[model samples]
Target: MSEVYAARRTRLREYCNAGGSAAALVSRPANVRYLAGAAPHGAVLLLGKTEDILVCGPSADRPSQERPDEALRVQTLPGAAGGDPAVAAADLAQGQGADSLAVEEHHLTVARHRALGSVAPRLRLAGLGGAVEQLRVVKDEEEISCMRIGAEIADQALGELLESILVGRTERHLALELERRLVDHGADGPAFPTSVATGPNAGRPGHRPTDRRVEEGDFLSVCLGATYRGYRCEIGRTFVIGTAPADWQIELYDLVFAAQRAGRESLVPGAACRDVDRAARQVLDSAGYTEGLTALTGHGVGLEIDEDPQLSPAAMGKLDACVPVTVEPGVHLPGRGGVRIDDTLVVRPEADGGPELLTITTKELLAL
Candidate 1:
């Protein structure tokens, strides 16, 4: 594991050199983990000219976890336990003859940046932008494996919910039960908020669970995922409450299912993010049901629930092979419930079975 982390750091170091910065300070927790393999509290990875180092506060337990020790030297702050570790790192880089250092401006606060400038007046500060995030867009086999396991855990939890009695149960209770099942089956935690919406609330993305009781004929839409080793995956399904479904319910479900499939099938390497969203959006739009659609059809998922490579109308950028992303498209009518089907998939070259699907649950609309 440490070796893999070391290799990732080497790649990041190359990126730093290409940006004309002799050193870089990574502070974002996930970016720190990507480079150091473990991100202790108040820890920062500094890529120096002569030697790279992971600088942490005095409280940081050195090499206590899977953090890489072979690729970079570890340094601890002096005099205090919780001082800004970035300032200390920048001071050390200045002493080591570093002329310029790159920092993650998007993650770092304005005050922290000013503190670094005060400590190392000679060192030129550069914005690292999303270089680390750009490198993380492509998933290694290990990262993909974590997401696959998370998806499986989520699927198992959802499967158990189907076997039991759902009628008369409140949406909030069922959502909580599914979350407990996820942890019981082995998950780091919930990837995002567990959404269980019933009736008119169904198909709404990011819907908070409510006390709405399950009725005889209602559309119950659930969206949930699990996090395993910092990687996250999402799964969503829409089900009918009663033993039978209404014509409108079946039609809406089929339409959403088809749109979801189109979005999933569009997860090829080099496909534009907007193109994928358009593929799914067109289906619902043609049916005159495009009034209240979510902005994004899908988004990249890995260390974070929502990352780069957003799949939306105004989004730009071509997908690359090995990028793990989600494909979710739905509609929420004002007074009527809707349908949503979501899955996690990896963009892959056509030769290697383009777009590896991580979530393997069936897409067929089920009636309970």
Candidate 2:
């Protein structure tokens, strides 16, 4: 497993050499894990030209192999307990004859950047800039496997909810129950906050779980996901309460469902990020519910819940194969309610079956 990390480091070293940097310091937790296999809390990775090192905080003694940190050279030489690992990584890079070091400016605070400069006066500091993030956009089979498992865990949790008596349950309680089920099914935790909006609160994007009890003739929308091995995926479903649904509720659910399908169908390799978002946004816009639309129709999922290639109007770049992203388009009408359908999928070419859906939870609106 360390060999896997060694190979990853070798590739990054090649990238650094090509970019004219002697070495690079990876301080972002996800990037550090990608390069070194394990990133202790507050640890930083120094990808020297020859040897790679994981510098841990002074007080950190326990290290786990969730992703296998043991594959890289470990250094528990933090200058002080809870001290900045980035500075120590910069010092190590300087000692290794690295004249120039690249750092993640977006992830590093200004104070830490200044400390690195002050600690290593001779070394030139450069921006690593989105290099690691770019590498992460197209995941390997191993990464997709983690996301697949996470999606399965989330589906199981949602499936169990369908069997229970949902009417009269508080939104907050249902959300918490789903999160607990995710953990019981072997997930690291919820990918994001579990959203359970009942009655008038339903269908809202990012709706915080409210205290409202489920009422008959109301829409119940739920969105949730689980994180496994640092990989995350999302799933959402909107349901009708009671034996029969109202005409307005059916119309809103169908519109949102179509928007979600459009977004999912647009998940092809080489599709523009904004174009995919537009595929869904247009449906809701023409329906006169465009006033409170969320900024993004969907976004990326991986080591972090929200990553690059944002499915928004202002986003740039085209989608690529092996990229795991979510397509969630939703609509929420104040005082009335709304509907949201979401799923995690991987962008694939037509030869390999267009887009591979990860979250397989039923999308058909069910009456509960």
Candidate 3:
């Protein structure tokens, strides 16, 4: 709704004003979508003192809103691949009497920043920093609902995969099929590239699918997520390829599962993010298998698959209610393969049933 966008922009405007800027140029697609409902390619949002405008290049696709938000005004630059939207936005800001404009330094490239300066020599540009990212960490009910549906779709796709035969299929085929299934189940697309690691690749975080064929007694790990209306959720599971798992496989699976459970249980309002990471890290550390652990047990998932509130040793933040994060504790042995378990959950107060588990698929070490 226009009112929703207007309220968000108002908050941003106040933030910019407090930072000594009368306008902010949002060049990051996610930030623009968060404030302007949609971000066509090469589009940027200019949060001015009086009006908000969405600036885009000539070749940019039009936003699909039949009736655009009244609070958002759209402006397209002339010529194909004409000019940078951020530069155009800066020019517009100067015309609108914006004395100082804040831009997302992390999102805007040095070249674009220079171009912006060149176009509006009098406009003072400041860094917006991570303001938009910070605002997105805490999820509203509507955003959470979209993520919930995405989690459900991912669960269904994984569940269907488990029921099918998997003796000699290549990793790429499985990954592609799972992606197709996600689309079939009402997903805009896969949140991120689907990962299907087998044998020595099992438990490898972000392992790209290869041509390796699934073997009879190998560890199979699959990590995938669905994007529903721009919200994303992730789910990962490791399974044994044969009728029964080896002794080493069972041991590693149990350890990772226990560690993952610890991480999940530590998610609560006011809990330090690093403390949550430690709870899971300690499990593998005590077992003398800490060398190959992922830097972070898990991370925040939202509009982008990996956003903020990182659950890592060096992280510095406290868990807040309504924040959704993934608790994925894993161990990857060099040539022997390993196990990883991941789940998406929302942090809530203990009285309200603690953290809500969005990925409901069984985490048991299943023998396929």
Candidate 4:
């Protein structure tokens, strides 16, 4: 809604004013979308002291589904020759008499930042930092609703995959099929690259799928998420390939499950982000499997798959209500393959409920 974008921009403008900037140029796609309601390719949002404008380059097809907020003016860069929208936005900000314009240094390239300066030397360029991302960490109900739907789609895809034959399928095929199922279940697409790790690759975080085929007695781990209406949620599970799991397999699965549950249970308002990681990491460390543990037990997820409030030992932040994060702690034992259980959940007040689980897929170590 236009009102939603307006409110978000108002908040961002307040942040800019607090930082002594008269205007802000949002060039990052996610930040632009968060503030302007839509970010077409090469689109940049200018939150000015007087007028908020969405600048776009020439495009054959505008994303009609993601219309810019009616309250904001949309300006296309002039002429048949395409130009950088951020540069044009800076010029517009200068025209509006904005003395200083804050920009996301992390998102903008050195060349692009220099281009903005070239266009409007009078407008002081200040670093916007991660202000927009910080604002996005705590989501509204509407954003959480999209993530909930995405989690459901991911669970449905994973459930369907379990019912299918997996005796000899390649990891790449499995990953692709899961992604297709995500779309079939009404997802815009997979939130991130679908990971299907088999055998020794199981429990390896961010492992790219390869030609390894599923085989009996191998541990299979799948990490996937779905994007629903621009919101994302992740779910990961590890399963044994045979009708029964070996003793070592059972032990490893149970240990990882406990660690994941500990991390999930720690998703309460006011909990320190690192303490949550400690809750999960300690489980593996005590079990003598600390060497190959993932750097973070979990991370915040929303418009971006991995955003703010990182659940790592070195992280510094507190979880707040409506913050959606994934507790994905895993251990990889090199040649033996290991376990990883992950779920996306929204932190809520204890009176209403504890963390709300979006991904309902069973954590039981399923033996396929």
The CA lDDT of each predicted structure is: 0.88, 0.88, 0.91, 0.92
Off by over 4 Å in 4: 60-64
- Please, what are the lDDT tens digits per residue for candidate 4 over residues 65-120? 57778888888876687889999889989999999999999999999999999999
- lDDT (Cα) of model 4: 0.92
Pairs that collide in candidate 2 are 38-69, 203-338
Q: How does residue 86 of candidate 1 score in lDDT? A: 91
lDDT of 3 by residue, 1-368 (tens): 77877888888888889999999999898888888888788889999867888887888774343233566789888875577888888998999998899999998889889999999999999999999899889998998999999999999999999999987999999999999999999998999999999999989999999999999999999999999988899999999998899898999999999999999999999999999999999999999986867888989999899989999999998999999999999999889778889999999999999999999999989999
| Ranked candidates (lDDT, high to low) | 4, 3, 1, 2
Q: For residues 1-368, what per-residue lDDT tens digits would candidate 2 score against the true structure?
A: 67767777778778888888989999888888777776667888898866788888876543343654565778886354556778888988898989899899999999999999999998999888888888888888999999999999999999999899988889999999999999999998999999999888998888899889998988999999998987889998999999988988888889999888999999999999999999999988988778888999999889888888799999999999999998998888889988888899999999998999999988887889
Q: Which candidate do you rate higher for lDDT, 2 or 3?
A: 3
Q: Rank the candidates by TM-score, best first.
A: 4, 3, 2, 1
Off by over 4 Å in 1: 58-70, 76-81
Q: What's the true lDDT of residue 96 in model 1? A: 84
State, as a TM-score between 0 and 1, how close model 4 is to the true structure: 0.98
Clashes of each: 0, 2, 0, 0
Clashes of 1: 0
Q: Give the total clashing residue pairs for model 3.
A: 0
TM-score of model 1 (CA atoms):
0.94
